[model samples]
Target: MESPERARLDAFFRHVTEQFPAGAPVTSLIVTHLLSERPAFLRAMSATSAVAAVLPKPRSIDQHTLEAVQSLYPVHDLSRELFADSTRALDYIEETAGGQDLVLADIGGYFAPSLSTLVEKFSGRVLGVVEDTENGHQRYAALDQLRCPVISVARSPLKDCEDHLVGRSIVFSADALVRARGDILTSRNACVLGFGKVGRAIAQTLRAHDLRVTVFDKDPVRRVQAHAHGFRTAATTTEAVRDAELVLCATGNLALRQDDFAALRNGAYLASVTSSEDELELTPLQDLYQRVPVGEQLTRYEITGHYFYVLADGGAVNFVHGAAVGTYIHLVQAEILAATAALSHGRFEPGLHSMPAADRQAIARIWLGHFER
Candidate 1:
């Protein structure tokens, strides 16, 4: 007998297939990280005549999974073959598409010149894209020219899955940090840069761990929100880090630069909760300061005679150190799948778009029904 959750997922997939018929041929080029663990997503794509090629992040590829993916479709590890060489990746995608209607991808496909190239070359053949990351959405929105619809989970008002999932994961990361660092977070002052969804969540998680949390965001509205939430707000990033024993960057944008390192208190642990080194400007920091590796994922930097520790090499602390949020990510993936189906049905216009409210509600309902039980 099919489990209730499995039945619901099957019904959803069937509904999508009915709405977007295979006769129209909705071929897709999916680029993402951690594809192996999400078997349901892969199964849905396999059922569709639309799946053309899958490009997964190299770090996410395991030997067992790589074999499985290769047996189903042409699988390319994006980090190894594509990310470093977008032009080559584009060439591979163009060839694999082979005149089929191409649609849908994650952040790995939507960033930089790659998306522009797909839009230009594929034209009407390109239906839409699904971007889940804030940085990717910002990049796509800034493009002066866009040919297909863009559905962003990051920007969706109705789909609070990202926010909720990130919030839960932040607590996990905090727990791992506390365990590893000998209760440094216990009753200590921590600053969270960027008062966005992820930042606010990190602050809340820290507080739950008995840490005094302060938030810093350039946007006044977010700062006010943080203040209203009873968390202290810092006027500037520099001010936030100066006295903080722990600093977490959650702004999708670069929140800390090499110069900002000078402001951090000695022995302060700097970590990122958004996307990796981008939020903390790791390249410049490494160039400007003497770096000593504490472990595979943590580093110590000496600047101005003060020592500061960087968690996960300034990468996402939860992903690098703590357990993967598998269940939460599966929920987000369902939203992505729904958006892809909606796009295939030609329900959106040629611009950046949010996930349809109806879809968000449905996904949320199903998710809540499963978890609430």
Candidate 2:
């Protein structure tokens, strides 16, 4: 009904006054997600005004994916740290264990080949761990590591799965990415639509760039994080993008409904960093705008007096139009896993876990060394 830009502005003022009660500078906040896949979450941070950096995960990067990332940020692979104490059965092992030794074992739904190799290196030092579930015990039995001490990250899948998923493995360095998108920070407003890990990383990254960021999440818990960061939060998706000149949809959900984009500012760019362009659902708003053919696979639509450009059939604009920089950081992950395996030898124990901090530090050092060289 209203122009996208107008709607965005309304949402911005509402959130600024309502959600951001602390009066902290917009650039000081860094919002993050404790769950979900990485890439789709991080890019959404680009929409805000104070975003400084985007820290993403290895799974979010591929060789094809890396090119877009390289053009946007300096990428590196580093092991994440651990802050939880837990047990491991087969499932538990996969959830709580780390280093190369923990990835080799599997129980029903739990497994990580990455850790098994490292187990060999650690040999007797490594103790196999898993969940306490029957399935976990069955898996540990199949691997025949009953002789070793076992642990579990959770009592069952429903309880422990979240821990397993949230437990950090490999993360990408986003200092370069933040620097690359530096121009967007310090604007009046920005929007980040996903509240997962990558989304949080993007917000933090943008903040590092001296930008302020606004966050919206489907999960209510994530929305509360806005208060902690001293940034604004939108109660709904459309509200999140209301004030944003650059709207990035990281939710990997339908990006734009007719109602969402109808009133956006002219010359504003809708960016997507999700796995697919499914986020740009245009049907709801298309009815309001008159469309004229601009080019093959490209249609021009007018809203109010402004023109909005949707890139690559709503595919990832960063990937399609921007310079290609494939995921070299994944290669580093593989190397880390391999090196940990070699160090452990062939006698590793099974378990769930996070990556070793030492291993992560090693990767960071190596990357720094290479960059310095």
Candidate 3:
């Protein structure tokens, strides 16, 4: 079989530039993708859009530098392929470290700044890890976790962070989490709050699977958009939760105040996709509200006649609980990001990297493709 890298690049050359004339005013193609394990790379991408951004490496190159450089050779088209290979490249890749306690880091889309934060927060706890890119080496000075140093593609103790956090709760293994997702998404009437990026994505994903969706947002335009998209839109977060069987907080705002719980119904599931669950002010809410634990990771918050179930303590439920995102989505997004960044002279840095322009375009294409079908 042709190498994934070769196939991806070949596809890029064959298809990525098909829109423009062979010699149109188009500039370059910037590429970026998810590295599965390394958080640093995603962080780097988030920090600054660079040109030819090698995962885990940093430089002062700017977008103008990319544009002035004539054309961009997007790295994601190749880097994602290379990154996917790194794990299988080493035999001892999955071996665990010295500690019995495991540390799972799910650094989504290795960009720079996010990756740096990963190095700072969890490198010391490294036992074994499944890094999706070569950037993992920058954070770990030694490959001590590799039991058989010479063997590539070996099992590493470092698990994907996404595999650990599920349904706003942490699971010890991927199997347990998978089982949980099977049950969670099957629940009736899930409510998604904060019609922002994460919220919208979650709602769309649920709807794609035929799950009933009701979205809430403070922004009038967003509410209108959600409603227009065939989702039930609520004017207030509290009202959205009132009828929801499950409540997902996707907003970046501090909306889930202690008093907010007072409005929730009994047995409703509450999960968050934002940065912090503490923003829910559970302690103050707990004072007046009574929530009970249901499943291993599920909680039941008793509010008036309703019981609200909270998952992952309101973290990014999809990231925490769901299985690996579909590879097709990842591939499309990575390719688009790479192409766009390259055109603008920015390299795809890893770690909380911004959604690449090409990837965004690709999303539009995918949506159009689906619509046309």
Candidate 4:
């Protein structure tokens, strides 16, 4: 495979940065997934100049990326501490800022537990927040009171490209896991739960690998889109999982709960592309069956004589094998970089805001020009 286009990512990130000048530089508490092209994006944004602390997600962050963050922002000792304990990461925000208000560059809305808690705990100290990821957007949107301008790129068209690539990465990891079990891909029919951008992409990727894919989503419109795209659609989650040998959850909510696993196909491979707790639950397995370890990241559990294999310990399967998506990682990171810079300007009022379409268009234009050239 070709190497990740880090040079293109660096250039594109710098281009995005140039569009939005950091008006009044403010100390920021940043949370991000430290993976391919991320370090280059941060360096291009001159992230250290405005960083107070950085909390790299434990699931996605690696030693090389951690070292890069260390070198980029050598001044902050808190960054390391926060990365170690993410709960403490949110707590540090409440304690620190030294007097000046801090900007929060959040990924996945890890800091925002709820609307009331966020408004109660971090109103004045946090001047504004720049958020990415659909999960984060939902968390911030539910909040009625806003003390700071919350800028998000989760719903932007620019992010959709990255989400599609993310779905491919999810499928890549799932295929690898199943293959590791000595199973052939074509022998199993796959079903994707959740027909959003990522879910649609997952279904397509599965189909590309010669798996007859069936998809299900809570949204009827998404199901219609899936059918229109030449894929099978299920009316309900049970209908989706009952016949498929491989079931992948892309819904960013608790999709497969304790009882829901009962509807799964016999000896099915279960995996998710989003948060483990949010997408799949293992309480039924833990309570009913003895844990059987088939592999380091794979587990086998028997329910009612039906065997189910859980991948990546019920966490995001895409993240199991480094989730290498080459240059695709840069598109979202560039939008995130731009959003951070725009939030740093502090021009937006205390409310939820989206990444401007103009900015997204500008980033996409720059991205296509650089990579496609």
285-366 in candidate 1: lDDT tens per residue?
A: 6667899886555678986788888876665666653335544555566667777777767888988888766766776666
Query: What 10-residue stretch in candidate 1 is worst by lDDT?
Result: 15-24
Q: How many backbone clashes can be found in candidate 4?
A: 0
In candidate 3, how many clashes are counted?
Answer: 89
What are the models' TM-scores? Answer: 0.86, 0.39, 0.44, 0.87
Ranking by TM-score: 4, 1, 3, 2
What are the clash counts of all predictions, listed in order? 0, 86, 89, 0
The predicted structure with the larger lDDT, 1 or 4, is: 4
lDDT score of residue 47 within candidate 3:
25
- Considering summed lDDT, which 10 consecutive residues are worst modelled in model 2? 165-174
Residue 29 CA displacement from its true place in model 1, Å: 1.8
Q: In model 4, state the lDDT of residue 118.
A: 40
Lowest lDDT 10-mer window, candidate 4?
Answer: 74-83
> Sort by lDDT, best first: what order?
4, 1, 3, 2
Task: Say which prediction, candidate 2 or candidate 4, comes out ahead on TM-score.
Answer: 4
Which digits, one per residue and each the tens of the lDDT, describe model 4 over residues 1-373?
A: 1245555556566677777667666667667777654667667656423666667766666677788788766333423334235456545555655555566777766655532344445534566777877767777787667667888877777767778888998888887887887886775689999887788888888898899999998889888999999998899889889998999988776678888888987788998886676678776568787678997688988756778888988877887778776665667777767766676666688888887778778877887888875
For 1-373, candidate 3 gives per-residue lDDT tens digits of 1366344433433333344212212221122222332222232232223222222211112334333232322322222233334333121112322211222221222222222332233323222222222223223323233321111110121212221222223112212433565544454676777665446666766666566888888789999989988999877777887876666665544558876776776655566553333236676666665767666655666756655666655544444433243223333333333333332332323222333344445545643443333
lDDT of 3: 0.41
Query: On lDDT, who's better, 3 or 4?
Result: 4
lDDT of 2 by residue, 1-373 (tens): 1366334433433332222131212210111111222232223222221223222332233455455544654443322221012222223323323222222222221332223433443322343333322333334445533434333322322222222222111011112222243423354455767655445655655555465577888879888875477667888876777667555565645556656775566645455553232467765555666776554324456766767645334544343322222222222322222222332332334333333445445544443433333
